[model samples]
Target: MLKHILISVISNDKPGVVEAIAETVSDNGGNWLESSLSQLAGKFAGVIRVSVSPEQQEQLQSALSQLIEHGIWIKTEHIDADSAPKSDTTNAYIHALGPDRSGIVRELSRALAQHKINMAYLETALTSMPYSGDPLFDATGQLELPEGVDIPQLHDILDEIANNLALDLSLSETPFE
Candidate 1:
């Protein structure tokens, strides 16, 4: 039987970090399943889900511990697929484009909270051209909405806020994959 584990790793940003971590999993006979990795504020952080045979679990844990000794901190937890959150839950995606400002995230998140929506993913970037004095921000947010909520109503609310904020905003239903 394959044991599934969710592992989160945090370490100083450096070359070969991913390779070192992957080597540990490969050496322990774990199958790398899925991962989301990024570098933020000079630190490399990632979350990976892997599957390994029961016999290899201890080896995997030991390998991860060794990484900690080398300055990488890892946290691992066994996951029960049966208890994992279902993605079939309905959701929506909201994308906003406008001048970079301070209140965008706060206002949008407050709206989502009012509707009890869950944020699944959010990415924001500032786009600037050489010699340009101001920068524009593009942000995308994926939110999980209640099953029976009217999507049109949500879109209308977002539209109103976007217009008031002078932002070009769009909302669409994002199918669970």
Candidate 2:
């Protein structure tokens, strides 16, 4: 039987970080499943899923621990595949941009939570505006909304937040490719 595991890795940003991780997983006979990786503030961070034979679990974990010598910190968790829940929800992509300020995420999340929406993926970045050179914040995410949720109602709530925060926000059924 295959054992599923979720692994998190963090290290100082550098080339070969991903190569090192892939090598470690392959060396232990683990099949890389899915992953989300990013570099932030000079740190390489990622979460990944891998599957291997039940007997190789310990061996895989032990080999992964060796990554410490290379400056990578690894944490592993075993997943009960059987306990994974199934969801029948619709997804929408949300994009928000405005002057860099606090509480943008907080207000957006509050509104989504009130409507029973969940963020499947979210990315936020700070950049400089073209002419003003002022700091701007941009947030993009895929949200999962429960069945029968009112789309128009959600938009109205978000509009209120945008108006209060001086932000521009939009939602779409399709995510930008």
Give the count of colliding residue pairs in each prediction: 0, 0
Window of ten residues with lowest summed lDDT in model 1: 80-89
Give the residue spans of candidate 2 off by over 4 A: 82-84
For each candidate in turn, the TM-score is 0.82, 0.95
Summarize candidate 1's per-residue lDDT along 1-177 as a digit string, tens digits: 799989999999999889988999999999899899999889999999999999999899889879987788999999974655775567678788887788988888888888878888888878873577588878888888877777778888888879877789888776322
lDDT of 1 at 54: 93
**Candidate 1 accuracy as TM-score:** 0.82
lDDT scores for all predictions?
0.85, 0.92
Residue-level lDDT of model 2, residues 40-118, one tens digit each, is 9999999999999998899999999999999999999999756444677998999999998989999999899888899
Q: What is the lDDT of residue 114 in candidate 1?
A: 87
Candidate 1 off by > 4 Å: 129-131, 174-177
Q: Can you give the lDDT of residue 2 in candidate 1? A: 90
